[model samples]
Target: MNRRRLTRWLTVLLMSTSNLLALPALAADEAANALITRLSTEVLGSIKASASVRTGDVTTIIALVDATVMPHMNFKRMTASAVGPAWRQATPEQQKRLQDEFKTLLVRTYAGAVAQVADLSVVVMPLRASPQDKEVVVRTEIKGRGDPVQLDYRLERTSGDGAGWKIYNLNVMGVWLVETYRSQFAQEVNTKGIDGLIATLADRNKVNASKG
Candidate 1:
């Protein structure tokens, strides 16, 4: 994707993550829509207000992600889903490293785009799902200087104490984030094998980390 499109998608993804942070306090069924409506503007406002984020300060952006985004994301499931069949074949240590590096890669890759959130507004579409369903797709539209972009989220409900919803996949302009990465990751695995992919990710992360 071009940089502008990538920036818009990242902005929407960050807003979605900010919404997820409130899942624990909401009922499972109401969690998705409520959070989306409640925090969409707040997220945009925060990003616009933060000088460090707007200036692409990696440390601040990474810290914001760690604090607000990571907790509500099903990174293990996301990484596993993105890796596809390769996930089951990898060793536990490799899995850990993959998740770590993948998380770092995402945080670093989008750190600069957080600034692009300015002037954005989100509209949560009407949700369609039965109350008993464990998973649902929350559709939304992000509007700014251009046409509204379609951004959707797939969330699975969890049970037990303090349990609610966690996001596993996201779709921006009809492109599923995990699947997009999955295709690229599959290519890397096909050519370099899993270890090589891991090393590549680790090296890329190191370079991104040094940018701040």
Candidate 2:
């Protein structure tokens, strides 16, 4: 997808997450919607107010994500899923490296997308999910200029440290994030083994860091 499309949906994704620093006491059924609530505007304000954040600075965005986004995402699950079956073959260290690099890639890309957006507001749709369900799709639309853009999330309920209904994947314009990365990751794994894929990600992150 083009950068603008990625930016549009990513802005929705990133802004929707700022409130995750504190999960609600509400049940899982309501938690997703509540988490995606208008409180997210709080983060948007913080971002827009900061000159660094508005400039698409990865360092600034990384700090924001490290605090808000990291705690609520199933990054292990996200990384594993994106790596496909090759994840099983990876050593623990390799797995950790993959997760770190993948996360950096996403944060840096998000930095760019979020920077370009100056007019956007989120409207979360009613979540059609059962409390008994372990996984659910939370649909939302980005409202600003022109027609609203569609963005959705895939969250699975979990327990343990910093756990609630954590996001494992995201969907934008009918494109699933994990699946999109999987196609690219799988190709690198096939050509150069798991280590090769890790190296590629590391190289990419270094380039991104340099650009920042």
Candidate 3:
């Protein structure tokens, strides 16, 4: 090839390489932002659509969560993190039980709170993460009466048959959900052990259910 042609070709090749390197980061950023916005819209829409849900009915909210929220959440990971080191020692059966109770506690607890705030609009904050990051926090504000409530989600990009981003943890008003629960679970595990933690969750869920 001519000298000019060769230089142009090399420049084009360099540009293409740069773009290729940036694609993963761009893709991850867009995909994660879209996912968070979509999930928030869907949950809010469902809550607004159902009067029973707006009334803070746990049963209705449970249905909504199972249908809309649970699919995107990595509750197993959240539970394991919450349970801390005790999780490693627990049998499979115990783990399952812990997951069940933990799920119930979360659903019942937030179900009522979110139901009450169904009318509020969620504004997604700018996502601050690099292209190489597999896990990121998507921050948002729930706008309604009083100050805007801070709601943030920690999501991880996973690969496999169903490869995509999954939400594993949450933060409300600067307090991280898993970390908050971890402290309680750790205390329980320290004194009461794994079964004790499970029992505590189960009891809390039961009380919340009765209140609901």
Which predicted model would earn the best lDDT?
1
Residue range with the least summed lDDT across 10 consecutive positions in model 1:
11-20
Q: Tell me the number of clashing residue pairs for each predicted model.
A: 0, 0, 0
Per-residue CA lDDT of candidate 1, range 1-212, in tens? 46446644454455335533665656444567776666676677666777887767778767676787767767899999898899999999999999989888887777766666676788999889877888889888888776777778888888776477777887877888888889989998999999988988999998977875
Looking at model 2, residue 85 earns an lDDT score of 98
Task: Give a tens-digit lDDT track for model 3, residues 1-212.
Answer: 33332222222111111111223343334567676676566656655666875666667656655564444457789889999888999999999999989877766765555445455677888789886789998888767676766667788987753456767876766777688778989999999988888888889988988887
| Number of backbone clashes in candidate 2 | 0
Off by over 4 Å in 3: 1-30
Compare candidates 1 and 2 on lDDT and give the better one: 1
What TM-score against the true fold does each predicted structure earn?
A: 0.89, 0.88, 0.79
- Residues 64-139, candidate 2: write the lDDT tens digits: 7777777667889999999999999999999999999998888775676665555677788898987778888988
Order of the predicted models by lDDT, top scorer first: 1, 2, 3
RMSD of each: 2.4, 2.6, 16.1
Tell me the spans in candidate 2 whose CA falls farther than 4 Å from its real position: 1-4, 7-12, 23-30
Model 2 C-alpha lDDT versus the unseen true structure: 0.74
